[model samples]
Target: MRFDYSEFSGDQGFLSPDELFAPPNLMNFILQYGEQAMDAMANLEDEEEQAFIQQLIDAGLLEESTDEDGNRRLKMSPRLLRGLQHRALLEVFAEMKQGAKEGHSTREPGRTSERSDGTRPYRFGDPIGELDLPGSLQNAARRQVHRAVEEAREAGVEVPRGLRLPIGITPEDFQLHNTEGSADCATVMLIDLSGSMMRYGRFLQAKRVALGMSELIRGRFPLDTLQFVGFSSLAETLHERDLPLVMPKPVSIRDSQVRLRIPLEQAYANQEKIPLHFTNLQLGLRQARQILSRSGAANKQIFIVTDGQPTAHVTTHPATREDMLYLVYPPSDESSELTLREALRCQQRGIRIASFALMEDYWGMDWVGFIEKLTRLTRGTAFYCTSEDLASTVVESYLTGKKSKKFIH
Candidate 1:
């Protein structure tokens, strides 16, 4: 987007014209993940890379200042990440439309309907369209007419001044129009925590995916919510704060570190193991259904990150004798049948399930066949990703994917 040079003509101070528009996107990413971006920038010592960085700084996309050593360092600004860019875009678009249709009725879109549902109480700066007509007219008449009658003799003016248009709408006369807003969306993320995930570094992969996806959602979709669930022997939900530290302990801390030792001792003493049901695909699907069933958003989606032979039960109710069992005596009934059952469940609930799997381990590699079957049955896509790019792959796909309709039970 080009910055309007004319808008900077009368500016009295520091910021240049290019700087005004450049800040939004730059500020957004910075506010979303501050130190991460700065640290990433630190590693780029090439002149071309530095120049590219400066372009962003000049555009006001980045916040830059001199360090104690007098060297310039770059960082992202927070305002851009908080929907300011979107809001500014909306405002500019509205202004453009208004300018194009100037002199036409300023009637708002979807207004003129009789429903009082849109009526909002008066506020200090609201425009005149927002006024309660009866109250405003009553106040105006009392001031323009009744006051004239009561004060005419004292003012020494003619008994009635021919009709007056009560000096154009005053600041107090402006009334704001009220409108209803749509509800926010709620999302649930399910990650595979089966034994196989440990083999291919899939667990750590899922952690990165969770962190990046959360940041993305929190930034672009401010009104939406996200929940993370990891399932293995059983499903355990994760909190946002837990994502960054999910992997190995900080290697810098020595075993002799007193501070770390104290905490470790306490944590281990009180550590409670969350329930883990066998990689029961059936149980996870059933639980996910129950979770999505209660969400109040207009839409919902489920993302499963895993690499395992789904071994859970299938039916919503007790198993019947005829419900075929394929494995016995140290049974390995790792059939695709149960996966099909879960896919059907997701479909029935109008839930879209996107699965991310890895095939790096002897046992985990079987996940390829299982994920293929499930993705096809659920009408959701499957991804085969490397550990490094797993998070990016999943997040990119989700943010750009078509939004699906909410399934009603």
Candidate 2:
């Protein structure tokens, strides 16, 4: 089986350019699908496919090796993972540009005080110095014409063509300025790698966001510090080179039964093969705090990407009149409270938490309120989004938070 760059090119093909640039789709095909399926989807003849495969090897995007059984397979090279990350960042910035033209300003605090590339509806207490006079006048003129038409229709009077009315500028017609800014920041991104992330495909989205953020920081904010941490039963710091190799274990009844059947001896012997199935948010936060504490950057923050509530925590239990560390599983109030306590500890150390909740329904199990309270206690913010918007949301939140401190003071 071979890989073809043409498949992702913007020609008449099975995948559109937008879809090809999307990190989730590209990473899914490379990670989840087998080589044979990818070859079949590429639809190239054997000779063409083999040539493309050779090209990929020559370009250092893939490496070919044979197993002990003499079966050959292709594996992703670190270069390819880095390339995918760059592509994801480009796609996100492109989408942001499109959204800006459509009047969708970033939700960053104090954004209106930065500069004027566009205008937005003014609210009460907004500074008058930031108002866009031309835009406000145009809005008032449009409103006057609209009101005249509505009045004519209501009074049963004929509305004269090309009628003009005095324009009235009201507070409702006021506009505010918007702009983008940059700051030196240190960010630790914590991705949930528990069983639920795999079940709902949240893991894939989180990976894409991490990669995009890495690229964004490297290219745009060269002085910024960015770190990636994956957490399930525990938190482990991952470098950019280790990202593509990390895979979460899927949740399934069969897998659970198999795990249950494993003898304790054998399970301990094969510990490396087992994947973490519970969320240990406390450990993740602790690790993040440690990383940030070592950084000298004045602006430090944490971005947590998860789809559910905290399901595990670290605690000490009394054993033989001694305290022993224990992991609490299946999510209890104790776990949730411990997680919040850790977040507060981080907050006290001047670390801010920006949480992205991938699920939409907050009412289910009260997960929404849980996330809100978590962010609120940390003096940060929470965002509810879908997989489609995960990368953009993460990037924008970072940007918003980055600029907020600069303008607030």
Candidate 3:
């Protein structure tokens, strides 16, 4: 059941020795291609590679089965999935190590004046006193030289020998010394489990982000709390132990008709029969608020990772026996307003809402407006990014929020 380290120590055709052992790459491939990952492995001509695949099966890392159509498929075992989550967390830690050093201090501008060895692009409102004069000047010089070269190329004029460009010290060229600080914080990651997220593979990306953030908080800020909430037709709190096992349900044409007829509670009760397919953002925010209300941390923040507009909300009606719950769809203005109200409530509670709009460009103006307003109302930030950058973006946002005292109420 154990993997032979020596077999993977040597190169195997298209994959290098290191890649064969890299859990993140292997997990990503399997998540994206499913059975194809195993098929590719099985197709390998090398006996060592074949044995390696067999070991994965023997170790319960992978399960080979047939679908309803009798086609062979490979599924990742729970143990292997958990290992992948750990691997993803490690990758984030590795990225943090390569970036700025971690430590604790007051992020207030006037409270702490000491500067670290690192420098970052100067942000508006950063105290001028914190500026790194030498680094800023160098940045300005580089910009000026690049501009001069472009001007010469446009004019069809050869650069004069020994030409010296004057350094322009614009604010845009300023650089500030990086600072590190820490604060007690409670963060809830609201992941969109709607059909669209699964359709585009964004759900998997978000899952990895959650795992990475969980690890970051657990390792770096031991006292801080990080909660994960997944929202589709309804919002549910997910424990860290169950995170690796979560999978998005595929959306079929009949999903819309079937999900709308069922109550949210009933759907949840029969989750295996009726999978979540609609985006219920309002429910997610409400749950986040409830979770954060119990936390004593000075800083409370909500990080939303979504790929589409809010398309559903919860409503109740009195029935003959009891009150019935329903999921309202088409993302009406009421739903949008309710979602905003929840965000405003969070703000009033001193909770900052930072949203990462994955695939925003592909979803059009409605998605853009929703995310922009959510962040603006809460006085938080919004980032539009691709799936490839989601993990790094989530980690950076969390770290920045922790270091900056402004996010604290």
Candidate 4:
């Protein structure tokens, strides 16, 4: 999963968390000496977490300063925040692997999913998706003029406001698209929150990618929509702000104790609520299919972010005596029933499925096979990204695929 960091530093000129910050951990330094820091630090020893805070500052992810008392402290940089926001946008519709191949209809007179043809006469019961806005307006105006003239003659009097044509569209007056047809496209993001995600320290990264993708779709594709599906035992929709916030570094014993008691520990870890399970790949895919169906788009797609072999399918599933003993450290499954169903469902709807595996170890040959099948079944792509280049790799893959779908000259 290791990647060459240099590959991410070229002309794209996008800033990283490091380039924008002051030298080091401003917050920890501040907490040690400052009086105004938040109460979250009450249980935290000032010097104990200094290194962690410093890492944030050195990475350019945070800014530091002291108040009148001259204490050390930190805050998130505006640049980093804006950059994260942009990343979120990129995540949603980074790239389309394919574009509409079908013809468009103009008769319906509104925006259609595909490329539009020229306009046509008004018709009754045409779909609004194909409506031709400009032509429809013109028809309304034309009808008004004709109605005025006819009324004047029939009434045998100069046309007054009542007799004059006040444009009104009847069933016969409605125009529709002349082209063939079109359909809207949709996508669903499946995030894995099994314990392995925590073990490999990728749970937070997955959340960021998920949020970014959702933001991208919301901003760019007015016609397209994205649904967030977090799967561990089962799948549930998550709000964008609820993404996980796992730190990039390790924690100490005292910190660990605090982490364990937090009412919603996962939420605190990632600064967002994330699902937890024992690597239930099957449950996740089943949830994804249900979510995709709700999108109601003409096309659907699924993206999976995971780092381990799926173990149990449900958080509450019963384990045998031997299996219970194994639960202390479960082996990666050689095959996954969930992945099989995921592939089938995606393929049935022409939905693409992509994977981003962010583990140092491949987990096992079985997991690799599952990843391969997931990609092949839906004809999507996959990437193995380590710590240094995970986000960049995802952005690259997304934008590249999107570019491929554009009708470039």
Predicted structure with the largest TM-score when compared to the true one: 2
Residues 1-409, model 3: lDDT tens digits: 3545455534555654334333556777765654456668656779897787777778677777787978666666666756666677767666543564354445553313356667778777777877889988888877777878888899999864443756558998898877644467888999887777765567777777877777666677888899999888778898876565566546644533332556656766887775467778888999999999999997888988888777676555556443233444555676677788888999999998888887635536466788777777777788877766778777876665442212110
Count backbone overlaps in model 2: 0
Over 146-229, each residue of candidate 1 has an lDDT whose tens digit, in order, gives 666878878888788654665433444433345422334566777765544555566655665565566656666666677877
In model 4, where is the ten-residue run with the lowest total lDDT? 252-261
Instruction: Give candidate 4's TM-score.
Output: 0.48
For each candidate in turn, the TM-score is: 0.44, 0.63, 0.62, 0.48
Task: Order the candidates by TM-score, highest first.
Answer: 2, 3, 4, 1
Better of 3 and 4 by TM-score: 3
True-vs-predicted CA distance for residue 203, candidate 4, Å: 2.5
* Model 1: residue 163 alpha-carbon error in angstroms: 33
Give the clash count for each candidate: 13, 0, 1, 41
Q: Candidate 4 residues 189-303, lDDT tens each? A: 7777555565544664565565566555556455767676665533456654434232212221222111111122233345333334445566566667777767767667676
Instruction: Please write out the lDDT profile of model 2 over residues 1-409, one tens digit for every residue.
Output: 3445544545665755444343345456654433443344344458976786677677576667767977566666766776777766776776553433322233554543247556678888777888889989888888888888999999999985663755678998888776443346789999887777765566666777777888887776778889988887567898876665576645432332221222323433564654456677888999999999999986788988887777666654345343222334444677789899999999999988888877743455467667878977887877777766777777876664532211100
**Candidate 2 global lDDT:** 0.68
Worst 10 residues of 3 by lDDT: 400-409
Q: What stretches of model 1 exceed 4 Å from their correct place?
A: 1-185, 245-278, 314-336, 362-366, 402-409
